[model samples]
Target: MSENITLTVNGEPREVEQGTTGTDLFGGDKAVLVMRIDGELRDLFREIPDGASVEPVTAQDPEGLAVLRHSAAHVLAQAVQQINPSAKLGIGPPVTDGFYYDFDVAEAFTPDDLKKLEKAMQRIVNEGQTFNRRVITDAEGLEELAHEPYKCELIGLKGNAANAAEGAEAEVGGGELTIYDNVRRDGTVAWGDLCRGPHVPSTKVLGNAFKLMRSAAAYWRGSEKNPQLQRIYGTAWPTKDELKAYLERLAEAEKRDHRKLGAELDLFSFPENIGPGLPVFHPKGGIIKREMEDYVRRRHIEEGFSYVGTPHIAKEDLFYTSGHLPYYADGMFPPLDVDGQNYRLKAMNCPMHNEIFRSRGRSYRELPLRFFEFGTVYRDEKSGVLSGLTRVRMITQDDSHSYVTPEQAPGEIKHLLDFILGLLRDFGMNDFYLELSTRDVDGDKKDKFIGTDEQWDIATKVLSDVALESGLELVPDPGGAAFYGPKISVQARDAIGRTWQMSTIQYDFNQPARFGLEYQAADGSRQQPVMVHSAKFGSIERFLGVLVEHYAGAFPAWLAPVQVLAVPVAEEYYDYLQDVAMKLREAGVRVEVDMSDDRFPKKIRNASKSKAPFILIAGEEDRDNGAVSFRFRDGSQKNGVPVADAIAEITRVITERQNTDPTAG
Candidate 1:
């Protein structure tokens, strides 16, 4: 029986028969399809359920393909258990690029073993086996899994994984649990796993558009304390072309990796001896950071922020007053004892900035007193999760705080939104989206919050309204708010379609009240002032890291460590090239002359490898002509241009922030 149901297909309304699967909407074309009901992903066979909204998705939408890949993971898990009966099933979940499944096995699964598993998965998908879901009483499940120790452990957890087990952790807490059993056409159950599923209907939905990527050891549940499990990684698509594209994108991203570029370009380093997560900025690295920080400093001053400095190690009382010690102590470096008093490397700038406000008796005129600082902080991160500059222990945050009267808070917030976004754009980043996070009102730790309900309601509204009225698209992130306040976060999308959080403006009431901060009002009443903590470059170190990945280390001439490098054809031309460097320096450009005894071609290659935006080649004839030949990083050259003309063009490009040389060959 067909009933009338309407759906918005790719932004246009279309009528369809009831009970129509998402695959039916695609008309059997086998394109990667993302489907959602009322803006949320629903499996293809998701019931129409009486006029529910549905939207078809394409492989172009990354999430759509992820759902397809996640479904493929279940197929792989079922195939593995089918081939190796003793291989205990674990958890497999979709990740950023694809999915990985963990298993408790007696021996490592080699590359050869992965090929065998891939073949088995292919056979299952080719067979068109259906995935069936079963829900049973918790007690019944305990009996069914009694023989499987790992499943027994999960059953004991009620599925709250405490110890990391195969593919997941085993903890105790939560709701009734369920298992998904993959069944053959004959209704025989071939394999099953404890799971929370929204899987595609059958293995055929995975098609032949998937491949096993790699095999690695994963802690049973991503916890270091848990038993290790062999995890097989894989990617899947609704079509072959999409799968191929995804693999190519993965390769491109790898090639543009910041760690690799940093070493090759001689920009930064993190020596193992210097310690994990503590990055060292080389001379070139220092230049990049200096430019970034100097730019930020100018913006802060222009925005009416008064610069301030604070000691890196502060008395533990500071954090205790800020209420960070007992609750957030885990993420911070351990405290150090100093002069019979305990101290700690600052993990936050709010506490110190609070003391600065208390330095004088503030007045209503100074109600919105803004203090700014570039404070370095430290944290002790878990070793297993550490990665390049992305997840570092030491970072210098470009932080600021504005104390404002309740009535002035809104304007302050609006100014912050515009200013932060503007600064990010100037750094050659244009794509931006915002997320406004607020407190978990229904959480158990609700009492951990400090502000009165009225203050909370006002602050949250001001932030949300500012984000909305600023003409920027913003999404509300429930329960994503800081423990002490609500926040607005701005993220920039990189060239490879990845997003990075670059700026944040959080409205905090907890810190002000915790430190007993207040100002004398117009009526002579000592009233608590609200605090707006914001950072355009969340951390200078982290911002540089994001910019590195954004431009793939090919920074614009304005921000490049060495914007111009001169290659002298002979030692006799060195004096002329050195003069050229001086000219560029006088023109406010970072330039260098290659004076080493290396060959000219070798010097040019070294400059290009360092991502220099322009290369100046000085030869005898060119030097004699009071000119120099120019080569650009983007493969263009200008022959025998006068030194004055070259300087004028290069300086114009640098001043205008033009990434490509227009006058080059």
Candidate 2:
């Protein structure tokens, strides 16, 4: 039990303590580029076990790749300090798809400066400087960091963080603090950063597969009160091919940015005078919104859901009964005095729905009541956090609350999950993932939740069992649940690999008790019904924004605001084409006849740019022949199809709501 450790790394023998660091012996040498300890990632400063075999982690391993990127960020920070010595460094963490470092600089960095910084980063990596760790006392740490204001701030923050770790009532805790020193071979310090040590052995391990992305102004600690810091973004990967692919995808994602596409397509806008985070959808965008809602309503009705409507605002007493005052009141729009009493623009539709259920005493036969509503709610999202239609203050949720008995909750939950899967499929989202969010066991690590242990256990089990039985790959997210309940979040992957959460099925035992909702069972006793709150497309506006990005503004036939554009080859064919357009309009196709005096090609180009799924080219010859030239957006052309056949085909595509096949690309 007390033996020292001896391990072999890359065929080299090294003797160390019971906890031997993989980075210490093999980390300094040139044999291993990356390291792995006990099958998990440990920074070079981590201690290892006695007689345990240590293997070198390489760039090929997925876990090791982030360290490479983190090291690249350090090199980039060094380059920034070289140019601007006063630039104070902040923490840089490895993020998905890339890494970013914050800097308090004298001036903003431009595109030209990014190029120079990238060049300097390459030079540092080429130098192959050694990375070592240094241990110092708390007082010594403050002295070493005296020159850097931000570093001093970080040291101050550490004290606060440690106090938090101890608990609300402070208890004594002890641990040694350390820093990483990036020293050169000639005994000159290249760079020294106060970080928990875990880095590549030397700068040579980094490759040229890195890029410096755009610079953005970010507030310190995400709070506007702190000074604005310039953050330089960058991406790194193990291979040149992966890096190139990432850059290409980034370019494509930018092209499909929903805010940009919203204006270009005349879909939606936000007025500055209307205050921030509130979107006003134009008439054109309203068409798509209504279509999406109608689709959901029809499906829910078929699944035995009863449509319901509620008021936009409610009395403050209603919220108190539903227990929204302390936990969720912050996100709500401010209360206003109505007739000497307070009222709030409802932030969640569930409370109102609860009032409806309580108005009537329910029998056991009335169990599993599903109520559906497209309720609009208001929130007070600060201006700086708002972005396009994705983050809006005034939005509507496709919200539904289902009340089911404890015994029937599992089956009802499964049915709802299956229903959501079908709806997503219809909307062209096939790839999905599920996350089961639960309360953290170690609440002392942070703020523990306030629910009773028995309530927490029951709610967690309910959602967890449903998620397992649904046959979805379940990922447990610690400390991610709503304050009152646990939820199973349904996320979808877009055309790109990024995942977004679009639906959530939450179980709330607390809310039912808060409102004292009950049903008379067959035994003639009142019992609490387990409440299930579910939303398929979480919000209409947010879902539409996601659709815009997923389809890249190329909506399918059924959802296109203007599905068909009938362009006459010349003015000569206008009357005949106008007649044809009316027939198609009667057939329920969104058709518009081109009346502009512009040339036919220009009109066709405009229609294509509008992203209409169908373009009917009606010329004099085709009008006489009772035929039409059909052109598709994807560069496919069909010549001289009978007008009737073209109409039938277009209707079929619209009625079926076909999506692009993944195999096609």
Candidate 3:
């Protein structure tokens, strides 16, 4: 007879057989794909222990979704190996929104091959294959996976955590080695993978809600030194409807892909000769950039920020003082040896700004001194991470640093937060939330962060209180703080509901002391003033990229590169349209006459394709009546308006920063 034991399940005490498996305990509930035993996720096939807290994890839970995607990745790898027995597996890891499995194969996978693999995966999913987990010795793992060199190498690194690579987390970790066997219904193992897994009970739970997205070349373990492997990317959802929704979002994201829109709109380009992650803004893009700079420059002046200029490169020791070297060396360009001194392209502007604050400073009255600059900086971004303007090596930051007494730090942070929010709202992005990044006090990781315990505590509380007082939802991001201090980053959602980290407000106590900055206090004692760093438009190039995607390349009237396009209805009306264009230009509107020899309809088509906010059309009737027709971006027209009214309307739309078509209103 089997013995019984009491277990705390879902906050309820229950009696079950001593050797009850998770599947049997949960009675094979389809929704309960996995179970949490005492806080640790375990395979359903693993027997539950007596007197343990148990909770069912459904496919909708975040952890369960990861397991689902990871299990699906295993199915995909099994299908690939079945089709090509020579193919060897490297690693399969669950990533954001999906998972990807790397395989060392002789031939690159094509689109047709992906369809074949999908069918094979579907067959495996229908097989109801049970995933059996087995604990094995490291030597056994190595011998079993001897044919797969990558797996064997990972097995050798079984207990070493520091040397583990990105995808290695899915295959190796913990004190023990384990492998997951895909057992067929006939009680025979169909395939197996060396993994640290708590997979779903059966493959059939994957249902038909998974898809193979695409394939790309990826280095094994994300290291450029390793051999390149073909990586198959895929996504899995709990239901078909959810899958369809995710696919729709993907389609929308593809439509808003900034790189494609940038070229089509003639905004920017990344030339091969210039090097990766470096972009050249065309004339049209330049206009938008200039407008942003002009607006911010004027605003900074109003906000009592003294404009300052810094060089593009600085000596290496300055960064060591700011605590960036060694820790942040990989992200910085290699230093240049100049006259026995090492100079590096500036990767951050704070250190130089700190120098400016310490150049010559005194008195309490100058306590809240603020300096702003459109400083250009560069980072040694890897080629794989570069994506047009969004991830560029060269960046121009609207960087500002403020020095204030400890008592005044709170007020300064509030002012900066308001400035950032207003600036984002002006740019047509109003949805926002604040994320407070605090230092990780956890073991080992804590050493990566600097600053005394009191300093960190004070700075974290100040940012947290300020963010909370603003009534914006504040999310905690532990281990996300900069080396020197804590920060609050504004995450703004755009037109398509995608969040972009826009501005940052960081409080630094370490740098101020490191630089030995001091100011005379009102009590007649020298003290270190708190240094706060703020970047309104985190990086101008990246901001432009976000805006391009936010508006899908059809910018607001005020932000549109060419605010007005004047097209004549015929050759005879060209001179009349030029007269109207002159009036618009006088009204401070960016207007140009389309004098091309193309026919009127084609001219209109060209203007529409340009995505100009306003199009002015002139014809014989308009010339006779001293009027012109207004064509808005939505293909709507308000015809036969006097030239004066047309000019005033266009000027109003542009000046008011209208995001919608004027005619729509």
Candidate 4:
């Protein structure tokens, strides 16, 4: 008689044969791609331990999707090798929405090459080869993967995979080395690769939902010091429909790309003479920027924040005092020698803010001291990562710092959170979720973060509690916190359901102590104050980029650079429209009249292309009636409105900050 073992399967107690595997427990469910045993994902074919907690991981789950993509990457690598036998493997890892496998080949892959590889990969997927995992020693891994120098090097760094490379953790980690072999029905190994994985049972799980994206040159292990390799990117989905949906989203995102809109609208430009990652806003762009700054500055003043300013560069020792020099040194520009001392461009404004706080004495009555600034800071971002305004070297931050007693930290954080949410809503971003970023206490880089266990726990709990109280969906981001403290970041989704990290409220317990900042408590004893850092718009440049994409360049009337453009229906109506434009300009509207030799229709087309929120048209009927036709975005028109009513309606939309098309109703 076969013995049976008791197990908790998906939160239910069950009995199965002692040697039962995940494949046996979940074989009937085609949606289940893998199994989670004691919180770790495992292959379905792996045997389950007695009394172990087992849960089915479906392809719809995030982890299972990653496993599916990783398996597809292996198949992709196999297809590459089959075509180009001389190609050597680097590393293949699942990234956001897809997977990429790097190869050391003689030639870069072309579009035709990708199509050929897709066909080859489809054949492998049809073969339904089983993914068989095998454990091996370091010596065996080195010997078996000798032809792949990159793999051999990764094997050599098995235990310290975190320090090895960006994606090396997907290949080898602090455990016994393993290799996954693609086994055919004849019990013959078709291909294999060194990886630490929990893959799906077979290539069939990938289905026909995978596609080869494109190929690019990437440095081995993500370092310029290493050899460059041809990296092929691909994406996989659970079903064909999901893949199609993802492709559609990609198309939509491409249409809404901010860089393309910024150039087409002549809003901003990254001139080569000004250097990469530095954007110079055109006059039109400057107007929008000014409006945003003016609104945010007024809101800050109303929220009890004192406006302040700080220099662009400061002594390097000041960063060391704030614990940014040694920890965040890489993000800062190289130090400049000034007056026999090292002066560095500020990558952050908190250190200087701390100096301002320490420059005075405080009492508990003024516990929540808030200081705000529109500080422009510089960072040494790599050229590879720079993407127009989204990722730039020069960033204008609406940075603020609040110093409070330990007991007052929670309330102050909540206040900031409310402020941030309201500010985002004012800009038409209503969808939001909060992220609680905490320290990674168990990670190898724990030493990089400085704080006592008790301090970190207290700070994290305060932020977590306040974020939960806000009633927004909270997501946890482990290892994403600043070196000094934990943070609550507001993640706002744009019009297309894409999330962006817009604002942040960080609970800092270390900076106060590092700077020796203190306040007199109610008991008349000196107590260390907790410092909170908040950025309503993380950076003006990045926020503007996001806004451009969110609105697709058709900004609301309040934010539009050219709020109203008056175009005459004929050359004779030019004087009437010019008069209307002058009236609008007097009413504090950014209005312009088209008085050029272009045709009336051409002028209207130009106004539409400029993305003006409201267009005023005057003709013979309007000239006699003392009215104008109000044309808006969306090709809708409201005709024959009195000039006074037209002006009132336009000014009302702008004053109310209406984000929708004014004439949509």
Candidate 5:
């Protein structure tokens, strides 16, 4: 030993022998899954440097969970290759809350195959194989991973990776290329993968807390043009309890899946002829959509927005003037030739709004002009990425644009941010945080962004300051901005704690200039106006989808397609129930009488299934007393309320926008 060296272990100075590994420093704490050496995560078995500040990463911490999941991914790959020797490796990267590995196999994996793989993985975990890191040159890596064409490709991109998608970072990003080998206690190599890793010390750290999820077909690197492969998804946690909890959450999420609930509630449908990503709202769904539109439109009028209408398609030259032609051509539908001119289905409303601003204007008094529209735009979303209404081809944006002088940019951004937050709150999505998405100034993506360097700097800082001043949590999303400008997005958490990007406020200095949008300034000078783009609901279709899941289809009374279901206890009480429903209708409650031949209990069950907020039942006693019984969504009831009083109470709830069953308390 070359003498002892001083190191700071959890803020306490300690002397350890030179070249002592982090595992030795934290030998007493088995729960310390990994160690952070000088603010950088490193393998516990890696040696610590002199004067290095080391901190233990417990199994419950985020970084520790990532390590556990990634190590579990490696074990999964090993199990797959062990079961099928010919299966070539692709990429196995950790994702949000889980990890998945892609493999090129002759046939897709079956459920039985996954079961076998899980058992094999557990065995490997119990064996406690050591994960050994080895630095290798490109030539050496290429030679070692010759069978893995995908890995070889990643090796070629060692320092210059073009992956914007998740999971690709595990292969290439930083300085050097390295391979991690799974070494058995007997000095025999069990398995390995080419990775830039800081994994847990051994397979034993994975424990029995991992379960192999289902497998699916995935393109090699998320590119449609790339080779397709079979991908196995798996989830790992620090303890079996956490794994059980995650599984329970997954079960709940599956039950709340909008597609399933949409069919059950008759809210929406995707017909075979309508094409994928195109959904047709049923009458019930249309009611919800219309209510949303009406509320947003009222808010726009109150907020001083000039409601404008634009055609669905525009001349191709219009997009070119707004910089969408060549840069955004991939995301836009191919142009239609009309009279020797090209016309495109608009992918965004901002370009058209710019055209409206430039149509005819010349006064400083109209400097901060705001335009609003429920503009339906079309986008060529990749087939693989399309899901229900959330990722549809035809999106209806509650889009608005504000054209202001350069000096008023900050104030206008703040105003839009406040409007977006209030709108989300009104829709019952109260839990929110702000995300500032700015240009990727330091990366290869700079060329993809428009506007001068000075303009980008000013726009980013202004948005950031406005976001920070809102007193909400601000998360930075570099490289997530649109090509034209930086943006602030509202991220709202739903009922089950899943975050959704609900609204966005983008600041643009390029498009106005590009479109030659000008307004006279206070000094009597023509100035290129700054543009602020905002979509309170992002898209009506998407927000409806989110709410369907958020509320589990039990919309509040005001938003529910049918607010009240009136049921008669007996045939003789039909007239009484109908009278009560008529009174409710007069009170602006959406009431429907169950005049069907079904029994009273079945009628109640139908109301429950429909998720109507209120159920009014009139029986012989109620008819004699001129009273109605109330049944709420949660199967609770309050009987013997006067019919007039019942109508007043129900209307009051709806008018007050209470997002709960009447008897929820």
Candidate 6:
């Protein structure tokens, strides 16, 4: 008689035969792509351990989706090998919304090649080939992957995968070496790769809901010094409808890309003369930026924050004191030697803000002291990573710091969270979730962080508690905290459903001690104040980029660079429109008048292209009637409105700072 093993299946105790596998429990459910036993993802064919907790991972789950994508990547690799037998493989990992596989091939993949690869992958997906995992020793792996140099290198760097390359984890991230083989119905090996995988049971599980997006050149292990391989990008979904929807969202996102919109709207540009990641805002973009700055500054003051200023450069020792020099040196530019002193461009404002806090002694009455600034900082961002405004070297942060006693930490964090959310909502970003980034106490790089374990635990709990109480979806990000302490980052979804990390509030107990910042308590005892770092707009440039994409470059009336553009019915009505524009200008509207040689229709078209919230059109009838016609951004028109009413309506929208469409009924 076979012995029965006790297992906790989905929180319920169950008895199964000793040799029972996950397939025995969940094979009937096609949605169950993989299983998690003892909190680690495993193949369905793997036997369940006695007394272990088990849960089915379906295609709809995040981990299940990653497994599906990884399986699709394997199919893609198989298809590539079928096409070009000489192609060597690199690591294939599932990333956000997709997976990518690197290949060392003779030539760069072209559009036609991608099409061919897709067809091949579909055939492989239809073949119903089973994925079989086998454990192997280092020598065995080296021998089996002798033809693939990258795989051998990964095997050699098994424990230290981080030093190898970016996606190397997918290949050698496990405790032991293993290879996944694509086996045919007859039990013959079709293809194989060195991997640490919990792939879908079979290639057929991928179905036709996978696509080969494109191919690009990527360095091996993400190092420029290494050989460049052609990386094929792809996405996988549980259903065809989901795949279609994802593609549609991608199309819409491309249309709303900030870089493209910035160029077409004449908002901002990255001039080659100024170098990469440095953007110059045009007059239109400047207007939006100035408005943002003014509004945020006013809100900070209203929220009991004192506006402060800091220099662009500081001595190197200050960063060392702040513990940013060694940990954050990669993101900072090289230091400048000024009269035998090393002066470095500031990558953050917290160290300088710490100086201000330590500049004076404080009492417990000023418990939650807050300081805010619009500090422009520079980073040494890699050229490859630089995007239009979102990933720039020059970042203007609405940075703030709150100094409070340990007892006031939670409340202060709650206040900062509320302020951050409110500011985001005011800017038309209402959809949000929170992420709690905590220290990696068990990680290999634990020395990189500073603080006692007790301090870290208290700080993390304070942030986590506040985030959970806010009733928003909170995601845990272990090993993603700053060197000093944990943080709560606000991830906001834009119009197209793409999430961006907008604002953050970090709880730091180490910095105050490092800076020797103290406040006198009521008991006449001095205590180190806890520093909470908050950035309402993580960076002005990045926030503007997000807003540009969020609004699709058609900003609301209040944010529109040219709030009102006056177009003449003809060159004769130019004076009538100019008079109306002057009235609007006097009313504090950013108004412009079309007094060019262009035809009336051309002028109206130009106004429409400008994305002006309101357009005032004057003709002979309007000039004689002491009225002007209103043309809105949606192409709707209201004719014969009194000049006074037009000015009042526009002023009202701007004064109220309405973010909705002004023309909406």
Q: Which number leads on lDDT?
A: 4
Q: RMSD, model 4, all Cα superposed?
A: 1.7
List, residue by residue over 165-224, the lDDT tens digit for candidate 5: 357678665677889999999989998888878888788878888998899998877878
Cα-lDDT of candidate 2:
0.80
- The local distance difference test score of model 5 is 0.88
lDDT values, one for every candidate: 0.80, 0.80, 0.91, 0.93, 0.88, 0.92
- Alpha carbon deviation, residue 369, candidate 2 (Å): 0.8
Please give, for residues 323-413, the per-residue lDDT of candidate 2 as tens digits. Answer: 7776678888889998899999998899988988899899879979999999998888887778787788987988999999988888888
Winner of 3 and 6 under lDDT? 6
lDDT tens readout by residue for model 6, 1-665: 99999999999999999989999999999889999999999999999988999999998899899999988888999999999999999989999899999999999999999999999998878889999999999999999889999899999999988887777788889598899999988999999988899889988888889899999999998888989999999999999989999999999999899999999999999999989999999999999999999999999999989999999999999999999989999999999999999999999999999999889889999979999999999999998999889999999999999999889989999999999999998999999999999888788768878888998999999999999999999999988899999999999999888999999999998878889999999999999899999999999999999999999898988999989888888888877888888888888899988888999888889888888888889898999999998988778899999999989988999888878786543
The estimated TM-scores of all candidates read: 0.89, 0.92, 0.96, 0.97, 0.95, 0.96
Clashing pairs in 6: 165-221
What are the per-model numbers of colliding residue pairs? Answer: 9, 6, 0, 0, 0, 1
State the lDDT of candidate 4 residue by residue for 1-665, as single tens digits. Answer: 88999999989999999989999999999999999999999999999999999999997799999999999999999999999999999889899999999999999999999999999999999999999999999999889988989999999888889878877888996797999999997899999999999899999888899999899999988888999999999999999999999999999999889999999999999999989999999999999899999999999999999999999999999999999979999999999999899999999999999899889888989979999999999999999999989999999999999999888999999999999999999999999999999888897667778889999999999999999999899999998999999999899999999999999999998889999999888898999999999999999999999999999999999999999889998889988988888899999999988889999888989988989998889899999999999887778888999999999998999999988766553
- What C-alpha lDDT does candidate 4 achieve relative to the native structure? 0.93
Q: Candidate 5 vs candidate 6: which has greater TM-score?
A: 6
Question: 188, model 3: CA deviation in Å?
Answer: 2.3
Better of 4 and 6 by TM-score: 4
Give candidate 3's root-mean-square deviation (CA, Å). 1.8
Compose the digit string of candidate 3's lDDT tens values, residues 629-659: 8887778888899999888877877878766
Q: On a 0 to 1 TM-score scale, where does candidate 6 land against the true structure?
A: 0.96
Backbone clashes (count) for model 3? 0
Q: Would you list the clashing residue pairs of candidate 4?
A: none
Clashing pairs in 5: none
